[model samples]
Target: MASVQPKTRTFAGVALIDTPLVNAALQHARAIHDDMSFNHIHRSWVFGALIASKLPNFAAVDLEVHAVSAILHDLAWDYKSTFSTPDKRFEVDGANAAREFLGREAPDWDSRKRQLVWDAIALHTTSSIAKHKEPEVALCHFGIFADFIGPAFPGGIISKAAFSAVIEELPRLDFKEGVKQILCNLCKHKPETTYDSFAREFGIRFVDGYEVPSELERILNALDATAEV
Candidate 1:
């Protein structure tokens, strides 16, 4: 809920909500590693949570569970490998770790809430499961997709050219209308075995014109430059 002054320029025209969950998640994510380099996976989750929080549908969703799940979805990355290529085993491993950590630290959490958090984390990466069965699951799926495919962050794996191509093909892409179609297909159709692989092989390939603000671009460029050095 507290606003931190941006060390860099902020996007003025964007309708973005920096929720407490997002802020907390960002802090937790940054603390997960000493490098301080941005984690696209974590960034994606944070961005997704931010967008979801703004929607009227999110109000009906469980905030505590979703927030915890969103923040900890990739906590294993803190202990394992980077987001460019995540280990499926490590993601499952991270879910266990996240549940343990949350259970210990967040004592007020009830069993149902805890299960929701765990289920959300467990399923965050996989798409084989149906979105309609669970509203939180659907939301988490949508949130992650929106963040990865949306224009909040620059320098994502999906290039501008590819993003354009995907948008152009959206009308023809074989699935139901909207984000659900993409998620369902990615989960059900792809035989790559893991979400990371599916994303690398197919997800990033189809995307195109996500509007990256100049300020975010500058920050991303600076970060990339810093990483290179």
Candidate 2:
């Protein structure tokens, strides 16, 4: 049987893929995430997609994978959500959620597509790794950085009008404080999850009892068998 091509939705020069899978992913995100997070994820997808749409490797990007990954990038931000876990990193939670979502809602996506979504969401925050991974992962990272870093992001490749449109629609009300609040809450409650990641800094600066184990201390006495670097 012939495969159906995904639909492309474009407006004012901005384009996004529209499929049942992507639509379901968006709805799932909207239902679970608060205004700030929902808007931020959408902004990430737009920034990433806009940038990808301009790139030479644009053809290599899996639009649906990128969409779902960005839409569910911060699944752990809500501790009460379906993706929440007591002992996993936030990114891991998001990744697992994305993978599970794909499996349940898009069985035709195949393992590779689901894996791409997993990697994209899993590594969105780990820039050093994500940028070196698949185009979907790298583009997801780029979109996220674009949202946070704005016009100064790396190459400033995305068009100005598109950038403006994304922010205007999302309307970043308290985005900064909203992020701060989540990070600090993790420090206060899931401090172990905050260690050895970007959230560590928030814990150090904001949470009273949060502490990172020294590398040397871990060398002498560690938490697990995993290598520490």
Identify the candidate with maximal lDDT.
2
lDDT of each: 0.50, 0.83
Considering only N, C-alpha and C atoms within 3 Å, which residue pairs clash in candidate 1? Answer: 162-207, 162-208, 163-207, 163-208, 163-209, 164-208, 164-209
Candidate 2's residue-wise lDDT over 1-229, tens digit each? Answer: 9978779997436788988888898899899888889999988988888888778876777888888888889887766667878788888898998877777998776788888888888788889999899988898888998999777776658656667877887889899998998888877777777777898898888878788998788766654455453
- Which tens-of-lDDT digit does each residue in 1-229 have in candidate 1? 9966423212222223445544665576567643322334444444445545456656666544555666666665332233312334334555676677666666676877767766777677676762553666666666566544564333353345533433342222322233343333433333232334333333344434212235577689899999999
Off by over 4 Å in 2: 1-5, 223-229
Question: Using Cα atoms with residue i matched to residue i, what is each candidate's TM-score against the true structure?
Answer: 0.49, 0.91
Model 1 lowest lDDT segment of ten = 6-15
TM-score of 1: 0.49
Model 1: how far is 190 from its true place, Å?
20
How far residue 172's Cα lies from its native spot in candidate 2, in Å, is 0.5
